[model samples]
Target: MTTFLLFSFLQLAQPSAIQFTNQDLQLESNSGYIQLDWTAVEGSQYILQRSMQPDFTNSHTIYQGPDHASFVSGLDNGTYYYRVGDDEGHWSDTLTLKVEHQSMPLALTLFGLGFVVFAFTVFVVIKGVYTTSQS
Candidate 1:
C-alpha cells in the first residue's frame, strides 16, 4: 500500500507537458506577424518565450499571462524560435518560423504600376466629361 501511494504521489507532483496546438510548427511567413498558440490548463498561467537560437540559448520571455494565444507583430526578416511553458516551468518543444518579406524593389514596382493606372483612369474620365458637355 505504501509503495502504491508513493508512486501515485510522484505522478501527481510531476509537471504536465506543454504542447503547441500547431502540429506543423515549422513554417515560413511572408507577413510581419504571427499568432502563437498552445494548449492551456485551466486556472494556470503560461509563459511564452522567444529566441534566435533553436537550442533556446539566451531566450527571453515574450509573454506571461493566462492567454493561450499571442499575436506577435513587426518582426524583422529572420529565423525565430518559440516555446510555451506553464507556470511550473515545464516547457514545450520549440517551433521554428522563417520570415522573408517581399523585396523592396518589387514593392516599389507595384506602387509605380498602381500610380500609372490611377493617372490613366483620371485622364479618361475628364476627357469623357468634356466631350459630353461640349456636344
Candidate 2:
C-alpha cells in the first residue's frame, strides 16, 4: 500500500522549466579573446552562433555540444553578435560583443616608458657602486 501511494505522488509532480541564468548570458571580453558562458541544462546540447551583422544573415555556428562556455580568439576589432540555442530550438536573447585591439602607437609608447625606467635603474645602481668603492 505504501509503495502505491509514493508512485502516485511522484507521477503527479511536474518538472520545472529549464532556463539559462541571466547573469551567465552576458558576454565577457579580454585582451585577446571573447568568451560566452552560460548555465547548461542536463541532456541538452547548446548551439552558439556569431556574425558581424546584427541581422545574423551570415551567422555561422561556432559550437554545437554540451559545453557551458565558448571562447573565440584572433578576431579583428569590430562589433559582433551572438546567440545561443538548444537542440529543442529554444534560443536565448541576442547579445553584443565589442572588441578593440591595441594600436601600434600605444604599444610603442609603453615600450618607450619601460626602457626609460630600466635605464634609470641601471644608472642608480652604478652610482651607488662607485661611491661605495671610493669610500
RMSD of each: 3.3, 5.0
Candidate 2 lDDT over residue span 1-135, tens digit each:
999989888865633233435464445454657667766767778888898888899999999999968877887777888888888776767777777778889999999999999999999999999999999
Cα distance off (Å), candidate 2, residue 57? 1.5
**Per-residue CA lDDT of candidate 1, range 70-90, in tens?**
999998999999999987788
**Model 2: what TM-score?**
0.67
TM-score of 1: 0.83
Q: Give the range where candidate 1 is weakest over 10 consecutive residues by summed lDDT.
A: 14-23
Model 1's number of clashes is 0
* Best candidate according to TM-score: 1
The true-versus-predicted C-alpha distance at residue 122 of model 1, in Å, is 1.9
Q: What are the runs in model 2 whose C-alpha is more than 4 Å off? A: 1-32, 124-135
